[model samples]
Target: MNRIALLAASAAGLAVYAIAPAHAAVLPTDATETVTSCGNSRLQAGLATRVCAEITGTTVEFYGRVGLAGPPSPGGPAPAPRELLTTLSVEVAGAAAPRTQFTSALFTASNLEVRGTADTVPCGSTVRATFGVASYPYAANPVVHEVTVTC
Candidate 1:
């Protein structure tokens, strides 16, 4: 009878062990920022471009663009044509009223440059800005030249 009771106890322990949950290894969080050039299109003789910057471990995406502007064409031998002007608009993934959109006064016909700092980002957050430009009526397929800066 003692042998039978010992065998029953051993069977119950084995069953419990079989039904226990297994522990999984924890993965470290990624905090790197990834910048990508999403391509561009010609909009009424002006180029429209986009750059996407993603923050790791979160669903936040920073979308930036240099607004469309007409291509600079030479007037005549007397005076050269002035370069086009446009604004850059940057917005977070899901927020409103805190967006940053600045129109630059300095202009260029074939090249676009954007320079600024993002001060509204959270501390320890990785911020990156990508600037690009495309020349119209010159290149067959307007290719954007990109430069990325980390802040």
Candidate 2:
């Protein structure tokens, strides 16, 4: 009877754990960003990260990605790549509030990405964005960039 009771409790615990909802991001999801041009990139510890920005109408979008910068060792076992945190920070010259988003917990496969946007920017307005990445515990890196695009 004790063995049966233990098994029943274990099954109930597993059911509750499986039914728990996952945490969702507060920011809007990206619409398939094509990182055609990368303004900044960092290669460190066999990992490569890139950050870019683009404008559509009055909205500005930012992107960040992390992947393997080099091949793994050909020794007995390959080292598993650690998780990287990606942050996209955007601020308009005249805007009151800055927009920022952080994506971690790893993206598809090996590459990781985090994206966000700043909206209502005027035509030919100067926008500042920073793309940052950190290893695991920390997320985000890189430099700041100023961009102006026609409406």
Candidate 3:
């Protein structure tokens, strides 16, 4: 009986090991771009926003979210909480002009009506922009995101 239990345990362990992945999924590096949301407490008052990035080969796309607060009650001290209002997705493409050495490339999205700069670093790249809403009260100021990628 003891031998049978030991055999069962061994088989189970082997099965688990076999099912497990040999290695974790590695983030793309070569000619790839990544973007992330830089959360800000000041923007959290009546608005919420997030940024996301997708990279395929040498192309990179960015996404943004905008949120707004709900209405406040009559004579209430606090206003209603904020909620997601909309989302914006834009593809960033290099400009026609040559990029200066050690300077970031210029990218823009005419459809979304936004522009930003991207710079390469040792292991990855960083992006900084205001999502073209800096004048808006709820707009986040100079939102930044970074991702690791091979040059």
User: For residues 13-120, could you state the per-residue lDDT of candidate 2 as single tens digits?
Assistant: 999877853321112223444223345567633357666666555566767666767665676555554665666788877876767776665433356666675465
Q: Rank the candidates by lDDT, best first.
A: 2, 1, 3
TM-score of 3: 0.34
- For each candidate, what TM-score against the reference? 0.34, 0.59, 0.34
lDDT of candidate model 3 versus the reference:
0.37
The runs of at least 3 residues in candidate 2 whose Cα sits more than 4 Å from the true structure, single-residue gaps closed, are 1-36, 44-46, 74-78, 107-109, 136-140
Question: For residues 1-151, could you state the per-residue lDDT of candidate 3 as single tens digits?
Answer: 6999999999999998788443221245455344233423224323433454455443444444444333446686653333222323222123233222121222121112122234333434332222322322454243333333334
lDDT of 2 at 30: 33
Per lDDT, the best of the predicted structures is 2
Q: Could you tell me the TM-score of candidate 1?
A: 0.34
Better of 1 and 2 by lDDT: 2
* Deviating ranges (above 4 Å) for candidate 1: 1-33, 44-81, 119-151
Better of 1 and 2 by TM-score: 2
